[model samples]
Target chain A: MGFRSLKTKLLLAASLLVISSGVALSLLVSDQYSKSLIDSARHQAENLALSLAIESADKVLTHDLVALQKSLDHQMKSNRSLAYLFVVRDGQVLAHTFQKNFPQELLDANTVISEDGGNEQTIVSTTGERFIDIARPIFQGKAGLLRLGISEKSLERQVDELRMKMGLITLFILLTAIAGSLFLVKRITGPLGELARSVENIKQGSWDVKIRVSGRDEVTILAKSLINMAARLKHYTQRLENQKLELERAHNQTRIFCEIVRELGTV
Target chain B: MLFSITSIKPIAIFRVSLIIITALSNIGCSDHEQSKVVNFSNTITLEKPDTKQRGDKQLRVAIGAMVSPRESISIYQELLDYLGEKLGKEIVLEQRKTYSEINELLGKSEVDFAFVCSGPYVVGKEKYGLELLAAPEVNGSHFYNAYLIVNKDSRFNTIEDLRSKTFALTDPDSNTGKLAPIGWLKKIGEKPETFFGSLIYTYSHDNSILAVSRGFVDGASVDGLIWAYFNKTNPDLTSNTRVILKSENYGTPPVVATRQMSKSMKEAIKRALLGMRDDKRGAEILDRLMINRFVPAKDDWYNSIRDVIESAGVSMEPQDGLSKSEN
Candidate 1:
């Protein structure tokens, strides 16, 4: 709301620019970070699932069913991000790492890739948490599928952390820019305020009103202009006062002469 | 009017300056409170090589030597490639020369699946937790014989004739090569270590044939399928030997998987194998490998071979405890 000076208005405009751009940059960076986190996490999960599938192939062939179950359970314990795991053999549920509420949909799908086998999909857990379901074929499906569910929460957590950091950085940049602009505005507009203060004195014909002009910049130039204008007004006022004094003297002489002429005529 | 004209005081100039300073300070303070320096670097985006990225996972397979490593690859590489194609994963062939090595690989679960002899199948299933995947049916039978052969000129007519001569065995884990010979020796109140003057293992049926053909050993035991394979591919080796003894037919060697394999994967593999003979590429590879087609096998089908091995009760354990060179 302040149009106090051109300098002040310009400073306000610069502050607005800095804030808007900072916010825009923060949002753009946050979005990119979220996408990157999700993509990389899913890829890492895929690599791990495939390795587990390969390891389980011989164990399944050897009728070492307990080994696979125990392995899945052990992995789940160490990896908190691992939400669930199941082993299905001969179209029957053999073992799983789930505590309860097993997803029957996973088993029903068979996920059997006839020509090409490995597959992954997204799923929502019973507790309303999101997860990525990865399936790998053991012995190329000569045996069965090793299904694993990984939580997406960890990915989100990382993205959240990144966003917070970005927000802080944006705020920092914004404030720094605003402070810088305001400081510049004060330096440029200082002389204007000084001139305004002495303006009344210059208008009342007090020629002694002298403003302290600092620096050899635009402010100084404006001060010199104001000083010249005040000097001209003082000169014109002095001339007018002298003219009025002369006119008063002339009028008094005329009144005295008229009175003497009238007295002589009456005698 | 001139008296009323008063200049702005110095106090008003101070107020304007104070406002500007306060605004700048406020901006600075708020910025300090809100702005935090953050490093925007990460190490999460490395690239993977195309070769290493095969199917994004590696599945290992072992082919226990029915022959030498070179021959095994030549014979089974096509089938493994086909299987890999069907499974949509990379299949790495783990080649080991001796049946015991294959058994060890199975026991360690280092090998995902294997094509192994019937002799080693029982041993691995008992000791390494191997489950049968499928067996090859060659020439309309899912069975194989153990051939006891002698040089064409040798006067060896029966098992007793070679009692005091040097003999060659194929592999310790071989049903036909080691167990069959032991079965005969036990039946005659003798054993391989005591009955023969010297015993050497060739580690392959064809290698044993080469030993027997040149009279390096007076006699040897070999697989019937291998004998036929040699006969069809290279008749010179087979023509030089005569069958002095033949053991009863036993179930053929099978492709076995581990117990932890998923049912869907098992189903897919079984389906691919069963349908192999129907496909031209698969059939051609089967012919080159001297196999008719793969058929589903159950664990109980090899009971007769198991009985023969147990009946021998003779130590077929490796003499030097050294596996043959993979070369």
Candidate 2:
């Protein structure tokens, strides 16, 4: 039972190591991927907003709203991560990509934080969609402001995909490690089991049981020690048997001698 | 007896291997993640790098507001570059919101040459002796007309049907875009101020076209050449509109030079334009612009435009006065 429990403990220990290390590796990789993906997305958002601002300056200044609308539409087609885009001049929306009514709340939702209009905010639309609203100044605020909303949904989806992939990989590694640990436990416990059986045979007064084990490890050393003890025990048992036999023979002879004397005196 | 020693070594080895594997994996992941972020942020630059040398001789050329600014860039950037390459000078493209501003740029010699509207060319010639260099030969003709258009779905089938509806004009100093349309209105004893329910100046013919196509305005008058060009090239926009009226033909807008430009430079520019069709690159640009070639400018070609403007009782000031009042 004890030996069986030893196998259980070793298996538990191996499982614990694999699990802990796998969790740690998964966390490290997932965190890094999440951070890098978010940073890249934010940078893309900012660049897109900036380029649109640059392109929209002349159109806004000239009051060419048709051209501005065309540009906004074109830009919307190229980026799927974009939620919505518009241009605001003098607190009025000049052109927007909205197919229907423009959201009035969005105008006051995010404002330019910097003098040159590089500002951003996290906003939740009425539809429950989350976005990173980026604002940029056109002609240093002389022409207008360009407000672009980049959806965070795609980024979240990407990070989730990375985590899922990482989790599967970690699980594969854990399973392989556990299988390796099982093989190692068997290799280790196999020798100890043989030694245990030999000791049981000795307890049953059978000294002919083989206790020798082969290896350059501690188990082999233990088997060697057991073998030496068994040898001494066997020698002592043989001497004791010889002594008992002599004693029995002597006693018999004495009895017989006594009988002869008695026959002449009290046989 | 040595079971403790036996179990402890394997566990220790396992633990050590686990640690080493985790460390190596973490190292690999961190390096990859770092490189990925670097690659993502590396190529984004908002400003274009200027590759032209600063010491090069520069020629300032102004393009009038014939098309919207964005379209102007796509259409003319190459032609300007070709001109710069042939003349061995850096070309600086100047643009204005109105044709009058472009003519004013030529009036002050702020620009070496300009592509001006026929109306501005006529006014600039009388006001400042603006010399004509050459005219584009579109469909073997040096003349273009004005087109009054409405949305294809509109109930208006004629210009009179658009009496009290909204209307769009291209620019104040444009012949086909404004003068010809206003002249037709005046001939029928009506004024744009009181005739249309609302009026908006789009500053470029393409914008007017877009305005009509999108139903932002019920009617718009645009340069016929620009209308035809868009009809063929951008049918998505032009297919939404139907032309209802066509005006008498006027001189096609001409390339003009400031009086301060030397005669030799004028001749050289004329030669380059006239010979452009023979050069492969120049021929491509011309093909994109839908021009067969360039021909010598005839002064009498623009007389019809002058007659129309005069008959409409429109007196244009020679300078920024007309542009400012219209604004």
Candidate 3:
């Protein structure tokens, strides 16, 4: 391809850089936010699970199943993020807040109580939705364990919001960069455009062609130099035309004198 | 550059369109409905051990709750203070509504000592090795009975007349409120649950009395000493209640310490309690508690209460509360 205009090259380079950086920034921010969102959700889930475990221990010890069920129902009602809560004893579910029987998979005695009661795991519900399960051992199995399930729906919403915000920010920066780049390209290309027009006028035999670009930059200086060179070329062409006219007149005089001298010799 | 403004002009639209596309894609994601997760039990927070050692590690003690925390604190405040002064350790008092809770607390060695009923003492000793520290001598009496009470307006005169009517019991681990009734039921060739229309657990002996007086229940079983003390000092709450039946005398509750207590600490507490009758401050505390002195604890003193529990044929069996479904 023919060489692209200076303005086109500069504009493409600046735009590419700005757009790529914005995209990169948006991706970085989105990743960081998703991670923090998950971490925050997990932290909250762990805390809530531990709370449920300790609170239900006494009721389980006293065999207050009705009270335990009532309190569990209340907690579930109050907090929508909670998916399920249960108290397990002797490898059996003593009480649970699930509408159905306890999940049989969770009934496996393999529930490992993580240190700090943060034993969390991701589970897929029968409906295929993702959830976080937090299991806390109740006083070393003196009674049972308290298990809580937190839905990922809230975390999904948070991540979406973060992504939207990041998108808006990137767009704002990209738009601003594009607008500023147009103004800068115009500043450099405006004078160059004027210089090209002046050079065209000189080629078309207008000797008084002058470029009037108003700037102190290199483009304006190039315009000024082009105007000076055009003026000198016009002056030299007028002098050469005068000299050719004079030489034609001198040759005609010499021819007429030779014709008169031949007529005198014949007489 | 200005000549082909239109060719390059569409890029503005393209750039805006790309931004719009990105923004829309991000904003398109919305919160969706989640599946319902059923929960079964209440959640409680687990507290971790503090890295910073407590400046004043208290010798925690739980007092008997035949009375309210206020009254129990009053009755044992001076004695606990005297014990604390003698032991040279800060005293922390805890109280639970049920003897079962206290028993478990002592069983788990969460507290140093507990003033609990004779029934709890024996049961805990059998289960958790609880040791008797000392027994309080109230009016020079080391024994008391279970009082079966009814509202004053009731026409029933004896335990036999309360047939098929609702009755309240205190803690399952209570001697006067639970074991005595069970023993009486056993002697009459009846079951406690079937004898009463419904057996309600009031959790505390005082709560049982309140339940009966408030007409929430037809009758209740409580400690005779607690009822007598209330009958004298707190007439308003007990004016409508009367003891309809009383069981054979049994030993009063003893100040028992968990087996985990150090020998020196136990001896220091025993010495402080036994010497309370000699000190002016201690004597004043004893007078307020309505006790003459504290005598040494004996496992034999509670043998009669154990006999009552054994006679009642009470079985503390662990069971799954939920009934399984069989197809």
Candidate 4:
């Protein structure tokens, strides 16, 4: 039973190690991937803002509102990661791709005005959608400013997918590791389990217990050594039993002689 | 002995299991704390504009629509503030869609002074006695050129290749944008309406460059200085367009004032502009605008512009009250 429980403990230890390491590895992988994806997303947003700034420079300088609106609309349609975009000059909005009224709050949401060149920031909209607001200056803020809101939803979705995949992989690894550990534990403890049972029977005075040893490992050698010890113990016990019977017979004779001597003396 | 051994083994196993459980739980807790510590809030430092009280007199300075109004404001705001500080008066910036309107404001003395294109300076000088106050010295020269450009991918090698193709021109009152191109076409014995399939007035040199770059037009004539500036500052757009021809250099645009302004005010304003490069803040502003310094303007520098307009047979007529949309 003790050996059986030892196998259980060994299996438990193996499982704990596998579970902990697997989870840690999966978490680490997913976290790194998430960070990289977000960084690339930011880079993409910055590039898009710069391109838009270049395109909008001419439109803004000429006050070509129609062409500016067309460009903004076309960009919105082409880039799905774009949530919204707009051009602002001298505190006046030139054009925007919003379907409804442009949000007044967004104007102050990002503090990087055109004079600061290009920069990005994470912002949450009134609708609770997250975005990276990127700003690029047109003509060094002389012509106007172009602002793009790159949605984080797609990045989040991608990270979630990676996490899910990592989770599944970790689970598969854990299960496989556990199965392997179980088989290993059984192989290591099989002989020891039989030895334990034989010792238990010997303790109960059953010396005829058969010990079958197998393998070239230390366990097999240990079982062979225990078999020798059990045989020697059985022989010693048989000899001791015969000596005890003789001693009893001698005691009976001594008692009878003592009684006969006492009677003769009395006569 | 067996009881003790079995008891000790189970205890040892139990202790190891407990340690693992504790270590895993610790890992989980640390992960939670680390995640909680990650902050996503973003902010920046923005300088607030000054709101100081000003004197009763305000100097209304009109900036011509050479670039966009917003751009003009940003490029000139610091310089205007510097001038206002020197003059001890508040400066109010005014903008108009056409260069002629700004000229009219200067002509009427409605504005204290104005920035006008070389062509408008020529016309305003003839029409309204608009006196030159100062001119920006770019690369140590008070002159700029007209650039005839096409999309880099286009096979057009010269102005002749643009025949029967859409062409973009800047403002009608622009020297490099209009008269120079017209003079080039005249030299080739062609007229704008007859030589090109279509023509568009982009109202600004940057816009004209963009038109050509985006393939909205087959070719365009723009200010060489603006093209060079964009090429240096923003190559993404300028790189898409190739300059095929560069016209002879003409006088750069000059800051002019009406004849009615007192001589002392003009002298003081000219001194302020000429001395800008020596001042820390003013020099920084000039550097940002790619200007070397402000120099004294001579009427002779603009004679080439007058010659181009005359030779091209282009009218110096100011389309008064015309908005950008009409162009």
Candidate 5:
């Protein structure tokens, strides 16, 4: 394939630069915002879990599973961000709000805590949906875990908004850059185009044609050099023309003299 | 040939430099986005621990009144200077016209200390780690009431009589002005939008009170402390105003410090305030402020305020908290 024009190359470069930077900025802002949102959500989830754990502490101490289920439901309904709540005891699921099974990774025995509350962990399903799960340990006769599951939709929404804003800004930058590049290339190359036309005229024997050097750029310098060269060639050609005329005049005179000498000598 | 060579140097230099710059810029462009992402994330992590500690030295403090109000600014400046002298540091007091501005400042940790109404302190404590240092004693008690005021000539006698009339809320985040009225409305199975013909946030208790007295709004809720202050100092505003309803007593506005402050500094600040009402020099400033005393306080004084926030269905989570930390 033929190489692209310099203008095309420069424009492509500018566009790539703008897009990459914009994408990076968007990703950065989104990531920061997402992490903060997640942390906030985690803290909120922890607080919710603490409240739920405290509210059901008496029932949990008595090992009343039924009352625990009702309290979890009540708490989940009160918070719109909450997706599900599950109570686990002795590495077995005692109750869960959703019919879908909890991920085994989150239910790992080592992941479960028996004291000092617990930490939140994120899980992504095979379909690429994300969730933040906060697990708090309920200690009574037996160690139980109270887990609050919150959807990542809110964070995702925020990230999407940032991405959209960045995308628009990138598009604006790319368009301006491409337009500017084209305008600059045309402006700088205009003198070169004029120089080419003047050279063509010189080849057609129009040596007297004057070339103008209007700019301080390289193209103007090239025009000035070409004009000087044309002037020198014209000077040298004029000298050669004078020498030819002188030789012709001398030949004519010599012919006349030869005829006169021949006639006088014959007489 | 020598002339040509000399003439060509500048062109060659110019062309080479342009090519170099364009190439370098293009190369840099490719990685620019990724670097921004990396940098922002790094900043979040690096700055998290220092977020609370960053502006500690400057001592950003806000007063809950218009900065242009001569009386409010004078009282606030007096308090700040007094505190500054006790702490042996220069104090910068920020003035916010609305309760929301004070809340936002406190929430962002932009202000280290604030003299905010009981309502904003309650809402901010749960979201941002706000600790009560002292409560202002006026009229011999550390408590204030919210008065529902109407024009003196208005026929409205009770809260129910003001239905379908325009009402002015001091601020959306205000406790006594917005939350308390909403609570009363809720008890009667009505909402602000359903009960009032129109509602607007005046952004200040003084402005809301003025709006009610001027007949721009049919009624408004104001702090009794402010009403008393105007009654004693600027009676012209109160000449056309009369209280029609009153809310139960709630703790008065308090001086609050961020939870991030050091124990020693917190103690020094509390000592400075508690002694202010007793010291002859400090008492002079407090007397001009119409403050009777300053008493030691705790976090529990704001429980009623928390109850109002909880009842209002406002969530306390910082929208950017987790995402910023992760980045």
Candidate 6:
């Protein structure tokens, strides 16, 4: 049964596989890298908050809240990326450094800061930008919480740069894959296209047409086999025609002989 | 050809699967290897109490102010190597941006040692149990002063004239800029935020000096060490600036270790520093740092700074008491 060519289907399948796999890999790597960056940034922010808290520990213990606030604010301002800083005492925000409002959940005295050693959550700001909130307990007892946040803009920018690079690499890989598949398909099918045209020539009475075999592949073997089959069929048909002509000649002679015998007998 | 199509499908699928598996496996292996390398390099060092007995563990050291790779590559690498050799263990330097940051690192035991300014040390001493290790002597002096400066062309001649004028102070934990000025202001019965049109924290002595010199602010309080360094190196910064007042001498910034540090290790570090000025190579390094000597110091030396910090009207609580949220 005739069907769509195998070479064409294979090429299509291969191209799809390459492109899809490239996309999948790009996505996986992007996700992993982004996660790692966010995690490292959160860790850094937590360490920073811890340091600020320790530096102001005396003030916090002595109830010198003003000194603690000034020290924290001074630190947050030094690094422009830091957005908010707050120290919670007994479930209330004892001091905050940013003008923006903070989440009340962060101020709960009973809510233990997650020191789980990694980024816990990402919050979106009113502007729709994301930030990584890093919280650390200032003192194990008495003093409540010290939460620090840094806008993810910088980290996002870094991830975006990585994504762009990976995107370029993926694009290059996809293009190369397509180009390679096309070249390979053309190489395999070029001979078959030639074979089909040759068969058409034979159908149109070009008896001298012969198929050429160049390589030791299945297509080459098939081409060679088809050429042999076509040659044998042509030879067999010519022999059959010659045998019919010979039999007809013999029959005509016999008829003449019979007619001559009948005339002689009548005389 | 039609049969070949059926056969080629399975082959192609098999080859594609193999390629994908290989690619994924390679990627996974590389990721694993990279993580291993990162973990190996990031291992913290823990120091042993006995000085003569070499500890197989590592000691983690934290430093304030992030040092650029290009600027600190040689110095820090050498410092780590030197400390590792002396302690017979690995030494890591963790850089933070502020004195408070270093103090917190010490308090959390994330770092075993640090070099901190007087203000943060005073605050940390009361809170984190910080102990002094050594003090750097610059130009044969163990003391430095705070200079209150104003534009040479400005009308202000004395600290009193700064009323209703703009003022810039370095970090709140700065002994020279914030502490001394706070003490001076309180003695004169003036409040910084209320008396001045506005107050800003520059966070660095260099920035504070530049702000006043550029006339961005009417005046600024800066560290004398930074002022002298800039005057000798880059005269342009000092050319347009004049010192309006100077604070009394105070102990210079000290090299401090955490209270968790063993007495033996602390003594070793102290001995290393005090003798640093005497060692040929150590002396050269000290010279390059513009420090004339390494002197023995105690926590008491920073009491004056503690007094200033206590009097600074600024709250140590985390709150909105400072200038309106920073831009």
lDDT of each: 0.74, 0.80, 0.74, 0.79, 0.69, 0.69
lDDT of 1: 0.74
TM-score of 4: 0.64
Please say which candidate is ahead in lDDT: 1 or 6.
Answer: 1
Worst 10 residues of 2 chain B by lDDT: B33-42
Write the residue-wise lDDT of candidate 6 on A124-183 in tens digits.
Answer: 544566666655666442345676777879877887787788778878877797788888
Candidate 3 — which residues are off by over 4 angstroms?
A: A1-267, B1-57, B68-71, B316-327
DockQ of each: 0.03, 0.07, 0.03, 0.14, 0.02, 0.05
Model 4 chain B lDDT-worst window of ten: B32-41
Candidate 4, residues B174-286, lDDT tens digits: the string is 88877887889888899877888877777777788878889988998888888888898779879999989999889999999989888998998999999999999889989
Give residue B202's error in model 5 in angstroms. Answer: 0.8
lDDT of 6 by residue, B1-327 (tens): 355432555556657766775676356345321110011122222222112332447777765432221223333455556666766767754554456767888998777888776777788888898888888788777888889999999888888999888888776667786777777889888877677778887656767777888988999888787788778766898889999899987888888889988999899888877887677877777766667877998666677776676666555433243552121
Write model 3 residue lDDT over A1-267, tens digit each, in one string. Answer: 122566776677566656655665666667667667767878888888777777776566545577778989999999898888877765557777767544566544236555344466676655656677777887555547888777888877887787788778878887888789889989777777777778888888887865665768788778778878888888899889899889889889998999999999998
Task: Provide the interface RMSD of candidate 3 in angstroms, 1 decimal place.
Answer: 12.3
DockQ pick, better of 1 and 4: 4
TM-score of chain A of 1: 0.66
Residues B194-230 of candidate 2 have per-residue lDDT tens digits of 7887778888888888888888889999999889988
Docking class of 6: incorrect
List model 4's recovered fraction of native interface contacts, to 2 decimals: 0.04
Candidate 1 per-residue lDDT over residues A144-201, each given as its tens digit: 6788777778877887887688778878887888788878878776677777766876
TM-score-wise, the better of 1 and 3 is: 1
Candidate maximizing DockQ: 4
